[model samples]
Every structure is written in structure tokens, then in C-alpha cells.
Target: MSTTQSDRLRGLLEPLVDAKGLDLEDIELSRAGRRRMLRIVVDSDEGLDLDLCAELSREISDKLDETDVMGEDEYQLEVSSPGADRPLKEHRHYVRAVGRLVKFQLAEGGDLVARIVDVDDEGLDLEVPGVKGRKPTARRIAFTEIAKARVEIEFNRKDKKEEEA
Candidate 1:
């Protein structure tokens, strides 16, 4: 996508999302079959629900109808929250992923899979899982040392089961 078009779309939609108490995570315009698909990913500290997504979609559609930002093309607008595997790109993303398992690619070298225990402007405190019945170890990783990071989905986590109980 062109930078100008992306910027314009952000300008038009950011305010609407902010008003709804959500962060606009991303926007993508692509061709799906014969129709143009506009995907708007939103997120909130408290998380998002289906009802909120429906309301935001309606509001965004209304705003788009009043503007010429998308030109004359007939497009389908999809409003949704970021998925579980979304990359941890911002400080807020890290903060939100606290207590969740994450896989990190270090800039210096190597990879680490750990549960996020805490986060700050500079870095994160992670609880690295130990092997062979050993206890978990705490480690600190600076943001600068992280080449990339994403939340890891845990299907059979003990913590999750405990939480349910």
C-alpha cells in the first residue's frame, strides 16, 4: 500500500477508534475476489468483544460513507481485534502480554521462550521455564536485545486451568 493512502486512512480512522476507547492496531486494504477488503484491527487494554467490534464496524462504516477517503470503490470493511499471535512491537504490546508466554528472537543471538512477568520502558522481566524438573529462572531482557517477539498460545497451561477453577 502507498504511504500516503495509509497515512490518510490512519488520520480518518484513528479519531473514531479513540472515541470508542480502543487503539487502532493496523489497517490493510486488499483485494478479496472482486471486492476490496479493508481490514481494521483494533485493541484495548481491557480486551475486545464481539459486541464492541460490531459497534465499531458500524461507526467506521458510517464515517467512511461521509468521506471520500476510499474513493468510489465498493469495499467491505472488517473490524476486529488483533489475534493471539500478534507481534509485540510496542511498549504497550509488551505490557499487555505480561503473564503470557512469548517467544523472543534476540538481536545478539539465540531465541527464548518465557512468560512475561513485568515490563518497563527499557525492557522486560521474564520467567524462563527450566528443563528436567528444575525451577524456572528469572531473566531480564532489554528491548534493544530483542530482534522480534510474539505471544505464544498455550493450549494446556496449568495456570489457565487454575484460573478457570
Candidate 2:
């Protein structure tokens, strides 16, 4: 991994994302032979759509190309939304996933699968998405205990209503 190049790109992307009111999920810089790859993942308030990604990709690609940041090579620029299975590391990840199903590993070596109810300064509140006959159970989880947290793509009954509207 080219750490310096990646960091340089991060510096360039941060303000661009903020100015557009979008979150930068991740970035990757790779080179194979004479080709280079610059991938950027993004998310927004209305959720990520193909159109939005394409637009952002074109804009960023143009800017990057102008700067010659990827070096003089045939580079493929790919930009898209973070997949549903993306891990939620930051607090903002949970907030953006309020109506989505998620799975998180506990510090005690256990895991929880539930629908994220909300995210606040304190922590994330997730409601167990109807485990068989069991009703939704809300759990307040702190950041320290979150060993692994990622969005779950499977259908969750609890989030159905929210997704409908």
C-alpha cells in the first residue's frame, strides 16, 4: 500500500466530501503493472444511489486527472457506495444506519444482530429484529465493547415499516 499517496488523496477528498454533504466511507489506491486503480466509497443522506456515485466519480476523477495524482499511467477510477455489509466503525456509521440491520461483536466474545434504532453521543441503540417468537429487544452498546460492527443486508422485520416510507 502506498501510504503517502493514500494520505495525500485523503487530504484532497476530505473537503470535497464535506462540501457535498457526503461521507467518505473508504478509499483504495492500487497499481498493477502499467495500470492504476483509485477507488472511493461514499454515502449521503438519501442513501447512495447509482446516479450519485457516477456523478461523484466523474467529478473526482476529473479533479484527480487534472492533478496527475495517480501518476502517468492508465488508471481506472472507480467510485461507489459502501455496500450493505460494510463494517460500522465510527459513531456516524451507526447514525446513518438507523433503519438498517446490523451485526456487532461484543468485547466478551459474543455477537448481536439487530436493527439500529438510533445513534447518539452515548452509544448505539439496537433492537433485536424479532428473533423467531421473540419481540424486539433494545440494547445500548458502548463503543469500547464493539469488536466488530457491520451492516446486515438481510431483510429485517423491524426495519420494514421504516423502509416503506
What does the lDDT read for residue 36 in candidate 1? 93
- Per-residue lDDT of model 1, residues 1-165, tens digit only: 556877899999999999998999999999878789999999999999999999999999999999888999789999998999999999999999989999999998899999999999899999999999999999999999999999999987667468889
Runs in model 2 deviating more than 4 A are 1-3, 129-132, 156-165
How does each model score on lDDT?
A: 0.94, 0.80
Compose the digit string of candidate 2's lDDT tens values, residues 3-121.
68778888887777777779888888788787888889888766877777777887787778778567777888888888778888877778878878888898889888887887888
CA displacement after TM-score superposition, residue 126 of candidate 2 (Å):
2.2
**Candidate 1 Cα misplacement greater than 4 A, ranges:** 1-3, 158-165
Clashing pairs in 2: none
Task: Report the CA-based lDDT of candidate 1 relative to the real structure.
Answer: 0.94
Residue 157 C-alpha lDDT in model 1? 63
Q: C-alpha displacement of 125 in model 2, angstroms?
A: 1.9
